[model samples]
Target chain A: MVTLGHFLLFSGLLMAVGLYGVLTRRNLIAVLMSVEILLNAAALAFASAAAFREPHLFAGQIFALFIIVVAAAELSIGFAILLNVYRTHGAVTDDAISEMRG
Target chain B: MSLTAFYALAAFTLVFAVFAVTTANMVRAAFSLAITFFLIAGLYLLLGSPALAAIQFMVNASAIPIMTLFIIMMTRSRSSGAPRTWQIAAGLLAAAAALVFFKGAVGHHDGQINPVSPELLGSNLLQAALLPFEVASVLLLLAMVGAIALARRRSG
Candidate 1:
C-alpha cells in the first residue's frame, strides 16, 4: 500500500532532482524543463491529497489544472525570450551576451 | 497504503514528471511531461474527480505538451550553448523561490473544502464557479500572444 508517506517521499525526491537540474543546467530551455518537473511534482502531491482526504474537496485538483495551464503559458514566454536573446547575440549563452551590460 | 493501482499510477506519474523536469533533451522532456499530466489525471479519477481528470488528460497531456514539442522542433538547431553568471543568478533565484515555498507547503492549505464533484467540472464554464479555470485559459492566451509578439522582428 502506498501510504501518503510514500507519495510524499516520491514527490520530494522528484522535486530535489528537478532542483538539481534547475541549479546546474546552463541552457535556458533545460532550466525551463526543470521548472516544469517541479510544477508537476506539486500537482501530483495536490491530487494525491485530494484522493486521500474527504474525497469531496476538489479545489486541489482544480488548482493543479490551473497550475498546469499557467506553466504552459509561462513556458511560451520563456522560449520566446530565449529566442530574442539568440537573435540579437547569435548565441544563447549568458556569458557571451554580456556586452550590453554597459 | 497497499500497492493498489492508484498507488502504482501515482508512482508512474511522479517518475515521468521527474523525467520530464530533469532530462536535458527538450523533446524527451515534452514526452515525459505528457505522461506526467496523464498520471495526474488518473489521480484525479481515483479521487472521484473524473471531470477534472478528463480535462487534465485532454488539455494538459494532449494539447499543451504537443504544442511544446512543436515549438521545440521548430526552434531546434538554434545555438544555445550555455549561460553565464547572470543566467546562473536567475536560476538561483528560482531555486530560492522553490526552497521558500516548499518547506511550509504541507500545512498551507488555504481553500474551502469543496466536496469533490465530477459534475462540478463537467458543467458549462459560464455557470459554475469556473473563475479559476477561465482565468487560466486567459493566461494561456495571453502567453501565446505575448510570445508571438516578442518573437516578432524588431524593425531597425
Candidate 2:
C-alpha cells in the first residue's frame, strides 16, 4: 500500500538531494538546476497532499500548477541574468561574479 | 502493482537526480535532469493526477531541460569543477537538516486516491482559481518581455 507517508518520505529525500546540490555546486547554472530539483520536490509534496488530504481535491493541484508557472518565470529571468553575467564576467561560476564583495 | 512501480520509479528518480547534480559535464547533467523530471511525472501518475503528470512532463521534463541545455551551450559552461571539501561538508549538513525538517510530515493518513480528471481541473481553474490564472498569464507575459529585454544585444 502506497501511503501518504511514503510520498512524504520520497519528497523529503528529493529535498535533501536538491539542498545538497544547491549548497555544494559552484556553477551558477548547476545551482539553478538544484533549485529546480528543490521546486520539484515541493510540487510533489503539494500534489501528494492534494491527492491524499486536501479538503478541496483540486487545491493542491492548483498550488502545484502555480508553482510550475512561477518556476518557469523564475528560470527565464534567472537564465537571462546569468547570460548577462557571463557576458560581463566571461564565466558562470559563483567565484566569477564577485564584484559586489567588499 | 503501483507500490513496486513507485519504489522503482522513485529509486531511478533519485539516481538520475544525483547524477544530474554530481556530473561534471553540463550536457550530461541536463539530460539527467530531464530523465529525473520524466520519472517524477510517473510518480504524479501514481498519485492519481494525470493532468498534473502531463503538465509536469511538458514543462519540467521537456521545456526546462531544453532551456537549460541552451543556456549551457550559449555560456560554454561545458563542465563544472568539483565541490570543495568544505562545501561538501556544508552540503551534507544542509541535506541532513532538510531531512529532519520534513520528518514531521510523515504521519499516517488513510485517504483514498481520487483520480483528478482534466475537466475537473479545468473547471476548478476557471471557477475558483480564475483570478490567479489570469494573474499567472500576466506574469508569464511579463517574464517573456523581461527575458527578451535582459538577454537581447544592445547598441553601445
Candidate 3:
C-alpha cells in the first residue's frame, strides 16, 4: 500500500530536480520552465496531502487550484519580462543582462 | 491504492521532468515538460481528485507548453547550451539542500485516504474559498493586461 510518506518523498524528489534546473540553467526561458516544474511539484504535494490527510475541509486541493492560477499568472508576466529582456539584450541568457551587476 | 501503478507513474513523471530540465534542445525540453505535467495529472487522479487532474491536464499540460513553445519561437532560442562546471556543482548542492529540507518537513501520516468529489470541492469553493476565487479572477485579469502592456512595442 502506498502511504502519504511515499507521496511526500516523490514530491520532494521532483522539487529537487526542479531546484537543480533553476540553479544551473543559463537561459532565462529554461529557468522559467524549471520554475514551472517547481510549482507543479508543490501542487502535487498539496493534492496528495488533501487526499491523505485533510478530510474535512479539503483545503489542500483548493490550495492546489490557487497555486495553479498563480502559476499561470506568473508565467505570463515572466515571459513578458523575458521578451523585453530579449528585445534589449538580443539574447535570453542570464549573462546577457548584467546591467544591474555592481 | 495501487502501489505498482503509483510507482510506474512516478518514475515516468520524474524521468520526463529530468529530461525537460537537462536537455539542450529547447523544443524537446518543452515537450518533455508537457509530458511530465500530463503524467502528473494522472498522479492527481490517483490521489482521488478528478477535477484538479482535469484542470492540470488542460491548463498545465496543454496551455502552458504551447505558450512556452511560442515564446521559444518568438525569441528564436533553439538550444540553451550547457551549464558551466561551477554551475553544475552549485546545482548539485542546491538539489541536496532541497531534498534535505523537504525530507525534514514531511511528517509521518498514515490515514484513510478518501476521494474528493467535484460537488464537494465546488461547494467549498463557493462557500469557504469564495474570496480567494474572486481574487484569483482579478489577478488573472491583471496579469493579462500587464503582459500585453509590457510586451507591446514602444511607439514614438
Candidate 3 docking category? medium
Per-residue lDDT of candidate 2, residues A3-91 (tens digit): 88888889999999999999889999999999999999999999998888754849999999999999999999999999999999999
- Fnat values, one per model, are 0.34, 0.77, 0.77
Candidate 2's residue-wise lDDT over B24-107, tens digit each? 998999999999999999999998989999999999999999999999999999999899999999999999999998887777
**Superior by lDDT: candidate 1 or candidate 2:** 2
- What Cα-based lDDT does every candidate model obtain? 0.66, 0.93, 0.92
**Best model number under DockQ:** 2
Task: Write one digit per residue (lDDT tens) for candidate 1, span A25-61.
Answer: 6556666767777776777677656656654435566
Instruction: Answer with 1 or 3, whichever has the higher TM-score.
Output: 3
Question: B71-97 in candidate 1: lDDT tens per residue?
Answer: 566556322344357645665666566
Clashes of 1: 8
lDDT, model 3 = 0.92
| Residue A1, candidate 3: C-alpha displacement in angstroms | 0.6
Residue-level lDDT of model 3, residues A1-102, one tens digit each, is 777887888999999999999988889999999999999999999888879875777899999999999999999999999999999899999889988999
Model 2 chain A: weakest 10-residue lDDT segment is A48-57
